[model samples]
Target chain A: MAIKVHGIALSTCTGRVLLCLLEKGLEYEIVPLDLANSAHKKQPYLSLNPFGQIPAFEDGDVQIFESRAITKYLSRKYKDTGIDLLGSSSLTETTIVDTWMEVESHQYNVPMQKIIRQMIVNPAYGIASDEKIIEEELEKLGKVLDVYEERLSKCKYLAGDFYSLADLHHVPYLVYFMRTLKSSVITSRPHVNAWWKDISSRPASVKLAESMRI
Target chain B: MAIKVHGIALSTCTGRVLLCLLEKGLEYEIVPLDLANSAHKKQPYLSLNPFGQIPAFEDGDVQIFESRAITKYLSRKYKDTGIDLLGSSSLTETTIVDTWMEVESHQYNVPMQKIIRQMIVNPAYGIASDEKIIEEELEKLGKVLDVYEERLSKCKYLAGDFYSLADLHHVPYLVYFMRTLKSSVITSRPHVNAWWKDISSRPASVKLAESMRI
Candidate 1:
């Protein structure tokens, strides 16, 4: 059976896994759930992901949730078939990739998601945007981008010269940041701007962006 | 030369990497930065971790920051020594471990750290504790623990029957959670309490906990 993904295409985390699958040239089925009706919190879906989160994945008898974990699993399982996402040729290279991936999880994602929630998601739900919170998040994000600016000046990608999962992981949030919020936080830094343009222009990323319709 | 870690011994993140080193029985030296003196945010250290986070690690020519990333590098580099932290012998097992690790990062860490800051860290720095924030964080943490309780009731550890990085990652934060805050969230759930007891009682965890002097 082909691999299956249970998630909405518009979801950021779901888009992350889909982009990885696209990059790996893998065919999979997306089993969409009616998240509007809380389908994810119901019985059958909870069986797939006990946390009731979007983007549960399945391949043969193996099942997984957490989009980054799914992407890592796919990268390892199909290491020979596609681009080397892990970049694990050496211990140092692998450590570089892993380090940036954690930075994304712990640092970048927090402020970015907060910005998205405040500036985009809240407005969509008829809730007023908290300008103060957005300003704080923007400041935090700007500091994070300053570090990225410095890193990209030294290397072509977050991990290194190669485009690994670390770069791919930023695409979804950047798309939302650019299209929905139209933030200058990314474009203000020369190296970060160049890196963003480079990664977001990838054919696989373009495909996911088109699918997201944000 | 032994591996050198550039971080304070008392930091949760630094302790995280130290615990991993202990678990693997690796010899390492702590380069101990004075965070109270703003040493991490200044030059030299910023070059090692541009984000200026604690727990930058060095071995031979390779330098890495981010505690989880450091632990992962060690696990893969020393896979044959001590325990199999990744347990990636099979696809299913690896995915399980990775999924829970993401849970720790995305779900568990957020509120746990928030509560720690509000209830413990603030008072140590002579800042007033935010009771409202602590209550809100505790509610969020309680819900997360409910899921953990459900999972631990089914398996011996977060990932599976064997201990993995997923379980190991929780030790430092839980130590703070128990020692500094003395929160009843974990102890209130029987299975979660049992899981904590089982993992925290490991020889490596015990050694690190003692070193932390919580």
Candidate 2:
């Protein structure tokens, strides 16, 4: 049986797992959930992912959730097949990759989400954007980006010269983040701009991203 | 030169790395910071951890931040020496461990922190507890715990019969959450209560938690 991912393609977490599948050159199906009716948050889906989240994964007898976990699992399981994203069998390199991955989730993703919600989602729902929130989160994100700019100046990628899961992990949310008007948050930092361009423009990333609706 | 952890022992993130060091039987010194004056958020320390977080780690030429990443690096680097907090020598087992570790961070940690802040931190600071936030977070935590209860009933630990980092990741935060009045949020579920008792009573966890100064 082919691998299966049970979530919509357009969702960020789902897209993360899907992109990993594409990079690994694996065949899989997106078992679409009826989000309009909260189907993903309901019984059968909850049984698959008790947290009631998107992108529950299954491969024959194996099951996993959490987009990062699924991506990590796919990378490890198909280590021989895919482009290596876990740092080429070096613990030191993998540690660096793991460290930046944490930074992406904890530091970078937080302010990115807050800014996007304020600058994009709120406007779509006819809710006024909270200027204070946008300002504070943007400041927070800038500090993280400053760190990224410095790091990327030192290395070709967040983990080092090699592209790893750490870089791919940023793609899903960043695709949304870059769409917002404040994308200059990225463009203003030269090394960061180059790194983003490099990763987002990857054949696998670009191919998967094209299917992701704006 | 012993490993040095740069942060106060009592801090959550700091305690996280310290507990991992103890579990790994690694010698480490705590280089205390004056967090009351925001010393961690300032220069020199920011050089160690650009995000200005606690529990930055140093070992000879190696430096790492983020408690989970630090813990992971320690586990991998010392794979032969310590009680393996990662699952032992099995890719499938490691993936399951990784999955639950993500769950602890994303689903479990969020509600646990919110409940702790509203119930414990708020009250201690002369800020009245927000009952509404507490109620909602507790409900969220209860659902996650229900999943834990079901999972734990089937296996001795989250990643399976053997202990893993996924179980350990809950220690520092749950220590705080357990101190809150809403600790019944954990104790109310039988298997979860047993699981907590088992992990929390481990000598390394108990010894480090004692100096936590709650």
Candidate 3:
């Protein structure tokens, strides 16, 4: 039986899980949800993920949600099949990976998502984009990128020389931002821009980014 | 040599790392940073944690930052010492734990911390609490707890029957909220209240809670 992913491919979180599966060269089926009809907040989908979120995963008897968690699970489960994403080779390596993963969760994703919501989602729904909020988020994001610029200067990737889940996690959001919003925040920084180019150019990331267009 | 933690004892993020160490029965020394003096943003600390965040951990040659990351590192490093916080017994159990940990990161922590910042932190600094923001956060928090209530009714802990790192991560924020703000938000939900009692009553949690008073 193939692994089942309950989500829309165009969703940011769903894109996250899809990228992991792509990187692992794993075959899986996506069980699409009707977000327009509020299908996710209803009974069956709620049973899969109590939080009423997209991108829930099902494999055998195990079920999980939270894109990061699902990706981590897949990375650990399929680690032998593809490039190692978790960096479990050593305690130190794994710690560095985990540290940057936390950084992504706590720092980067919030502002990036906010910018997306304001610039993309709001306008798509006929709602006006709040320029002030976008500016504020961009400013905060710039500070975070300054830190990233420093870190990337020291290492090839956020975790270290190897490309881990930390780098993979940034792809969907960065792609969305680059497509919809001003790219200067990322492109302006030398190391950050170089790092972005390197990560986004990966075959797996390219495939995932292309899929997200639909 | 004991692990050296560079953070203030009373700080929430610092308290999180401390709770994990106490749970693992590890000896550690605190190298306090004067937050009011902006010591964390200065040289030595920035080198340890590029983000200039609280609670950077140092053990031998390994140095890590991000409170959750440090706790995860400690849990993985000391899995055999005390109770296994990661629950790496099976892929299923670990996935469940990781899911709730992400829930803690993405969902629960945000509004909870916002309410805390408004109700407690701002007031202490002579800033008035924004009632509207507090109400908004509490409403968002209420919905999250409804989901928690549903999850807790199914399992004894957030991950499952075992008290994993998922539960430990909630302690510092909940403790701060309960001590400073009203406890009714947690207490009102039957299952959530019971789970809180079970986690907060742990010996390690008790010690950490008491230590946070200073």
Residues A97-129, candidate 3: write the lDDT tens digits: 999999999999989999999987787789999
Better of 1 and 2 by DockQ: 1
What is candidate 2's CAPRI-style docking category based on DockQ? medium
- lDDT for B85 (candidate 2): 85
**DockQ of candidate 3 (2 decimals):** 0.87
lDDT, candidate 3, B17-78, per-residue tens? 99999999999999988788899998978999888889898998899999999999999889
If you score just chain A, what TM-score does every candidate get?
0.97, 0.95, 0.97
Give lDDT: candidate 3, residue A20: 94
Q: Write the per-residue lDDT of candidate 1 for residues A50-165, one digit (tens) a residue.
A: 88999999998888899999999999999997799988798778888988999999999999999989877788789999999999999998999999998999999999999998
Cα-lDDT of candidate 2: 0.88
Q: Which digits, one per residue and each the tens of the lDDT, describe model 2 over residues B1-214?
A: 7899999876777888888888888898899988879998999999899888888999888999998999999898898877888885887899899999999887888788788778666776789888898889888888889889999999999999988899988898888888767788789888899999999999999988798765
1 or 2: which has the higher lDDT? 1
Model 2 root mean square deviation, Cα atoms: 2.0
The candidate with the higher TM-score, 2 or 3, is 3
lDDT (Cα, 0-100) at B131 in candidate 1? 88
Kindly list the per-residue Cα lDDT of model 2 for residues A1-214, writing each as its tens digit.
8899999877788999999998999999889899889997899898889778898999999989899999999988898987999885787898999999899878888788788778766887789999999989999999999999999999999999999999999998788788878899999999999999999999888987788764
Best by lDDT: 3
Candidate 2 wrongly placed segments (more than 4 Å): A118-132, B122-129
State iRMS for model 2: 0.9
